[model samples]
Target: MKVLHVITGLGIGGAEQQLRLLLRHLPVRSSVVTLTNPGAVAAGIEADGTPVTHLGMTGNRDLGALPRLARFVRQGRYDLVHTHLYRACVYGRTAARLAGVRRVIATEHSLGETQIEGRPLSAGTRALYLASERLGTSTVAVSPSVARRLAEWGVPPERIRIVPNGIETDRFAFDAGARRRTRQALGLPEDAHVVGGVGRLTPGKRFDRLVRAVASIPDARLLLVGEGEHRAELLRVAGECGAADRVLLAGACEDPPAAASAGPALPELLAAMDVFVSTSPDETFGLAVVEALAAGLPVLYVACPAVDDLAPEAAPGARRIGESVPELISALRGIRDARLARLPLPAAARRYDIARSAEQLMTLYDQAVHGTPLPAK
Candidate 1:
């Protein structure tokens, strides 16, 4: 069955990467469509020989692509239209319905209201999301917290499915050579402890906090590897912390994994790091957290809404910090190697790895198309 996965953009992100894994091994005819330009994820998908359709949409209100997309869906006669993120979910599902495709599934990737300009959606937008959730054939949540958040927002519990985010064990595996080369290239001191950090440089991510956390740790350096609107503020904060010299703000690493090797990439970044630090106080699924674990890195995460619940016992070294620099410093210094190795990957993580996630995505496609529950596996 032909399936069309819809998303806002093909940028390097968890959702896009998840789609890439699906495209790689979903075991069915599948394609990706982006309302925006084909970004990093698009490049990877195309390199893998997967078909990608872009609408060249620069803004959220671009409706010009709708007709073309509808026509394409009609002609392709795809069995399922899987939507990711909010904007694309609305457009894809609406267009799919108009194009006579009944199976429309949406994955909710965020737990928060997704508000803009310090405001929740206007009344009309609220109605629209509510209606869409009710009308959607199925809703998949990357974490139970996301599912709970959706339910709190009015989506029925039964309509939501919890599918934990995963990593590509093969691609995101441990690599020592790449790690060494990456460290060498970075010109890191022989004894400097590396801290691998991932995620957008945004407010919710609290990258500034991370910079501050490591400021007091002599000879410790942080490598932040993502981009967002908060760069200026982060830089200013880093400067104020007096630790800018010790920080390696590697802006927008396209593929940490690809840059080095299995280990050199994100896995390498994660594996190479003496510590994996997540200061993001509110993460939906904490994709990078799990990826760090998959790399067998010692993780130190601030207490977020969903963090403690994620393999709590295994991450016993995991400590929650309450808005204090001293607490952050304490948490960073607390993580030991033995505690990190104890964190066991839950069974649900199997479904997240590229291959397994791809298979589960195919199964979800089948369920979406046929109105049947996904197979138990």
Candidate 2:
């Protein structure tokens, strides 16, 4: 089937990377359209043989862009239109309907209490989201926690489908050679204890807390991967914590597949570290934590609904820590080599394999198009 994916911006984030990975596995013809900046992720998607269109949507007030998007949808004659992120979902749903596309799917990737996209959710925003959501055939929630949040936001429970995010299990599998090579390439000391985190360097991610926690551990070094506007502030916070030299930032991964490369990619960056950390209190799904688990690293996180909701037997490497500086410092100090080495490798792979998720999604797509009853969840 011919499918068109509409997304807010093709940037290197969890949702965008997930879309790229899905395209690699999907057996249908797919194209991408970004409502705003078509950044590095766009390049990666194009590299994978998919065409990406950039709609120069200047601002939220750009009403003219709506007709332009609808025109493209009509001209492309797409069999299905799938949208991702808040802005893209709202506008893409409306445009798809205007173009007379009957089968439209939108994925709610990041929705949390008190915030939608790093901003306080206002009444006007909710109204807009609800109004636009009504135009879609169905909504896909990245996690069960996200489905509950969507129900709380007035989306009918029947309209929501739970499709947990998937990770490339084989890509993140631990390698002794990778560890040695990545550490050497990134200039990490062979014997130093490393604490790593991955995500956009934003205020909401609570990276400042990580800096403070790193300062409390004498021998621990911090490595954060991802790019954002908060880099300067993070640097300042690291300086204030007196751990500037101990903290290393590798910006963002352009092509997520490269993350597993033996070079300076995210998976390699993850390999160079001894432990994984997540300070974000509001996470719809903790993709990074799962990737760390795939890599056999012990994880310490706070309020990660994705990891928390998993069966205890599925992810033994994850530990939920209290939300405090002292607690973080204690967790960092408590991580031992034996504990990290004993992570549940086989169970994690079985739980989060991308192939399984891709197959499930293709089934959902067929059900949406043919108006068939959903299989038992």
* Tens digit of per-residue lDDT, candidate 2, span 112-197: 87788678888998889999988998899988899998999999998899877888788787777878888888788988888999
Query: Candidate 1 at residue 79, lDDT?
Result: 85
Report, for every candidate in turn, its global Cα lDDT versus the true structure: 0.70, 0.85
Clashes of each: 5, 0
| Best prediction by lDDT | 2
- Give the Å shift of residue 338 in candidate 2: 6.2
Error of 1 at 62 (Å): 2.6
List all candidate RMSDs to the true structure: 3.3, 1.8
- The TM-score of predicted model 1 comes to 0.88
Error of 1 at 116 (Å): 8.5
Worst 10 residues of 2 by lDDT: 254-263
